[model samples]
Target: MSTQRKIVFDAIGSVTTEQYDDPHAALEPGQVRVAAKYIGICGSDLHVLAGGHPFAQPPTVPGHEICAEVTEVGPEVEGVEVGDHVVVDPIMACGHCRACLAGRYNLCEPPMVAGFRAPGFGRTSQVVPARNLHIAPRDLPWQVLAFAEPATCARHCVGRLPESARENVLVIGAGTIGLSVIQALRIMGAGQITSVDLDPTKRQLAATLGADRTFAPGELDPAETFTGVIDVVAAQATLTEACTRVVAGGTVVVMGVPSGPREIPLPSMQRFERDLVSSGMYVPSDFADAIAWLADGRFDAARLVTDVFSLEDAPKAYARAQEPDSIKVLISLSD
Candidate 1:
């Protein structure tokens, strides 16, 4: 049997690339085999690498932002065919669940998400459900296609805001998601977009990505308010600041995964009549829109990719992803 290279985590805070015999098995019905090309490193992957993420278990592959070329399709697969480039939506919602039936699959009681709870896409070749793959523009760089997932996540965060918040938006944390939010808001024709972060590099990148202004955490006026305040870093301090700085009747969208239990000031929120919503996985429509946005060249998605590594350098890729200065790190399986 031929061998293929893959990154694997055997225990918490451990990572390694190993060559294993190719499965070379026939495609199961409704599945498509992809020659995985690029996989973007995500904060969730870093969390799992650091032994902190609750959903990820050891002895699993750890990547979700994927771009690949379809090499084979199962008998029943219809939309995807060989030679097509695509991005995979890793959200694996059980269609029969009440939340899914109600069109809120992101809120499924027992969450089953790829790269988080289920098997991930961090390998040379992978077989995924046909429904999870969305066709990509063959012309776009593989790195840009790899961003469809995170961009879809950003779309979900901004989509949850109220109509009033779309005009004047404040985004916290100029990380990948934060930068994605800036671009998404720009595409949506937002009025004023201000990004807040401690890192000057990220702040500058945010401004380039369409933020009207970029400020360090301490530079923003505590008394200043906006129609929408998105806290991408959902720690207690940031959450408190978001609730405090939001205008009365405005919306506060929490997109970050809180490190632990958080206490929201119910009295302040009630008094101001402010709205708060937590953002999670994107819906199917959001994924489609993300792919469309990338395909149409609505924004420079490639600008966000800061580093790339081969499959054998998976450990280095994760380390670079953990750096505060790094915008995006990707594993290039093909290139």
Candidate 2:
């Protein structure tokens, strides 16, 4: 039997690498065994490591943003084949759920998100449902393919904005998701995008990636308002600021996963007809669009990847990812 190496969050502030029997030997029908190429360290992964995630706790494997090469396909798998480079759509939904029935699996109740609610692709190899694999262009770098998940999320979040709110957009947070949001807005034809981040480096990167304006958190004018506001840093302060800074009839898209319960300006929202919407994980179409955008050069995938570490150095990668200067940190599992 082959062995696989995986990184696990043992507890708060603890990360460990362990070896396990490869599951590829028992791959079931409709499943594909993939050799992980690159796995991204997401904000949610950090939250889990800090014991702040609402749904995910420690003693779990953590890696959801994945780019892998298919090594083998099970009996019923057809579209995906060996030698294909694919991005894993980590959202696992039960087919019977109402949300899944409506093709809104991202909203499925108690959904099992790979690396959070379920085992993820943090290991050397993973057996995933073939349906979850999005065949990526062979020519795209694995680092670029690794961004499909975040880009899919950004696409979905931007799609949630009302047409009226798309004219003038303000994105809070210039991290991976925030930068992706800016790119998505531009590709979707939004006008006048502005970004806010605490890190000047991130702010500059935001401007480079299609944001018309970038500002440090404190530098933004309090009196200015935007037709749409996307809060990628869902902290209480950021949420309040986002709600207040949106135009009276505008929409605020909450894209960040809050660490804990937080309050919004409900009274103001009611008074002004301001819409508040939450973007959960993305749907299939969003993933497809993200891949298409990345393949067509609409999204600058390489720029988002700020750091890469070998799988053996995943703990260090996590620490580096937490640094303010790091945007997207990836663990390279294979060439």
Candidate 3:
């Protein structure tokens, strides 16, 4: 297609689909042209739409969790070719920064994340950096494969867990990230996994998705504590709960991207000597691991996407994702 359809966010609460010139008209070296197959609506996207994400601004194409088929590969790119199904890792970092130098690109300063500060792959086709492409089996549905990015984050967060915290893990929030954490913990051989969320629907889904027990936030006993608490929802209340519910010398992994600053219950955490680790986006290896899980059916990617909309209905998809019962909303770009 010489021209492609794209959804551009023009303002705090406005998004529209419009036609754009071919994204592949001029592909730089080390780049690959992809026909985006499916795109998942993430919590961060909602935050951006609400003018809450720090990296986002008006007049941007907003999407990051993506799955696509290679349409063309630059001469210098290797290991990928046309017709290959792949997941895109949208983190763009300044290579000279300390975080990038140390292989922690997710923590790069002045972050230029695709779909936020840079043009994202929300349209039919776009040119992508070769390094950001992760090849995946084409057998899985594009919607399922689109979860690779979020799954990668969950995988990275699980990798941060200490040995002592592998057992009796409590996952706070059964949203997409939390559900992903539940599956990752199961794959990591966690014991007595418990998931808590405000919505009963998500709690029940958590149980079906491998959580040993699912409970509403209010249903949890005040005295109960865990060796590890993964706060996937990282809002003020959830962060407070995560810090308060950890056992002595336990670890709390914060995986959420909060819209604004909030106070943490640091006194309790410090008194208990609890370790607080903040996890951001994943590295390339994390994306590979997630793809492997999805490839062999080790993880059920289908159940996580609770709603789907066409590329033209991305605005609707974002709104549905904000609903408490919606687990993951997807914008389907291909048949």
The C-alpha stretches of model 1 lying farther than 4 A from their native spots are none
Q: Give the TM-score of candidate 2.
A: 0.95
Weakest 10 consecutive residues of candidate 1 by summed lDDT: 1-10
* lDDT (Cα atoms) of all candidates against the true structure: 0.86, 0.90, 0.86
Candidate 1 residue-wise lDDT, 70-154, digit = tens: 9989989897879999888787778788888988878876677778887788888888889888887789878888888889998
lDDT of 3 at 94: 77
lDDT for residue 300 in candidate 3, whole number 0-100: 81
**Clash count, predicted structure 3:** 0
lDDT of 2 by residue, 118-147 (tens): 787788888889988899899988888898
After superposition, the stretches of candidate 2 with alpha carbons farther than 4 Å from their true spots are none
**Model 2 accuracy (lDDT, Cα):** 0.90
Each prediction's total of clashing residue pairs, residues at least 3 apart in sequence or on different chains, is 0, 0, 0
